[model samples]
Target: MATGANGQVGHELLRALTDISRDPDPHPYPSPGGRGVQCISPLPPGEGGAKRRVRGRPCEIIPAARNGTLENGTACERIDLADLDGLPRALDRIAPDLIVNAAAYTAVDRAEDETALALRINGDAVDVLGAWAKQHDARVVHYSTDYVFDGSATQPYREHDATHPVSAYGRSKLAGEIALRDSGARHLIFRTAWVYAARGHNFLRTMLRLGAERDELRVVDDQTGAPTPARLIAEVTALAIAQWTDDAAPLRDGVYHLVAAGQTSWCGFARAIFEHAQRAGLIERAPAVQAIRTSDYPTKAVRPAYSVLDTTKLRDAFGVALPDWQVGLDGVIAELANTRFMNREK
Candidate 1:
């Protein structure tokens, strides 16, 4: 089962599963033969929409059939993380073999203002779910962020480095990691950074829109990290799960960084986006990209100046390597083009 089904990672996970199911030689692990995978979480409200509260009621389960399939093959059920009282009922109903927890409070600046809500979802809810996984004897794949580090180190962060979060969002996510580790469930926690996708509201999409609408764009250059694609993260996650399921003896359990290879600052990233969009004919010209320090942005929360994480541990353990940032960016832009064409058809 997958939590945060509508999230960037969750959305891609569903799509990757569909692709895997259609492959001629599917992996032995998900036990394919039409066995369904269930996703749990509400559809995130649209931008600027009021958040909906789910009381202690039976979750609304949406069928997750393949794109062109004839029958319902997978499903995603909406559950409220705040309402722990209703969790037992939801778990009993699903009885999933594997649980992927990709849901979290990701608002970096807003998390400072909503500390209680952030702790409730990122910290307390994780403990609740981890405990449930322990009870059900199921494996869990939890998603984390790069903000856990303070960005002081010069080199790429290793899995064993100390986490000293500079922002409330980072602190809350670190708390979740602690909870997951303490829960005694077989789990894999991935600490990724600068995640983006074509469908979601991310840096790439924002830059493409702003670069088209304006002639000049100033982006932060102080912060540095890898730009991980949501699709690549999803694919690597599936491979990790397959390995864990097949060879339980050599299972990789603990925190590992899963990000695209190479690194770039926010300003450089914006410049790349504009360049790509201009080449794709999505925009008339590349905007004049100006590089500014983090102080210029004046955000409520302090961001890490350098949060580059080393993925050697993940590579050594899982034998999986992430492609370079540019390759991933190209794939995302291509996907965006396809999505635009598909939308035009409708």
Candidate 2:
């Protein structure tokens, strides 16, 4: 059961898992073999198809969202995590082997005023998921943010570092992490940073929109983190799920950072997006992006100045190493351009 099916990560996760589940031996790459220069091993024949099943049956996608299934019609489980009254009964009925929860209140600034709702969805709901998974001896895959830290570290944050969230959104997410840890459930908490997708409303798309409308845009240059693609995150997660069932893969359920190999500032990211857009013919020329500090773009929620995550542990444990941020950006930029071009043609 995958929550937030219509969301950026959830949507890609659905696609990746479905692709892997259908394939005989799906590797960690975007396509059949792999993309770019990344050295991802081809999936073991013993690991993929059979292991994705529960009781010798194919796993069903239960898109647990308030608005129900997407237009594609795969997931029919219309569940709202906020109002989880029927969660236990529903879990009892489904008895899912693994629950990948990609849902959360991601309104970073609005979470300050809507603390209750954020806590209800991000913190309390996760606690419930964890508890239920524990009861069923099932595994839970939960997504977390790097905002759990106050962005005070000069170096990348370690998994064992102390958490001090500055924003309400961060607090709620941190609470979810603590709840999952205490729930005693077999869970994998992935802490990622600067996530974006071609289809979703994110920084990459936002910059493209601004570039189309204006001649110049000011981006925060001080903030730094890897712009991780939702596709890579989902694919790696699908690989993790497949590997978890195989004893030889060594799946130790714990918190790990899953991010791109390299880092960049928001300014650098915007410049790259425009450059890619120009190359893809989405834009004729790159926009003039002005570099500014965090103080220039103040919001209700305080963002981290620097929140680079260390993914060495994840690579060492799961043998999953993500490609550089630029590589993922190129894929998304091309897709975005093609979609726009098609829409214009129509």
What are the clash counts of all predictions, listed in order? 0, 0
Strongest candidate by TM-score: 2
TM-score of 1: 0.84
TM-scores of the candidates are 0.84, 0.90
Against the hidden true structure, what lDDT does model 1 obtain?
0.74
Pairs with steric clashes in candidate 2: none
lDDT of each: 0.74, 0.81
Instruction: Write one digit per residue (lDDT tens) for candidate 2, span 66-182.
Output: 577775775467667788677677778878878999999999999999999999899998999999998888778999999999999999998988989999999999999989989
What's the residue-level lDDT of 304 in candidate 2?
87
* TM value for model 2: 0.90
Alpha carbon lDDT of residue 79, candidate 2?
62
lDDT of 1 at 320: 47
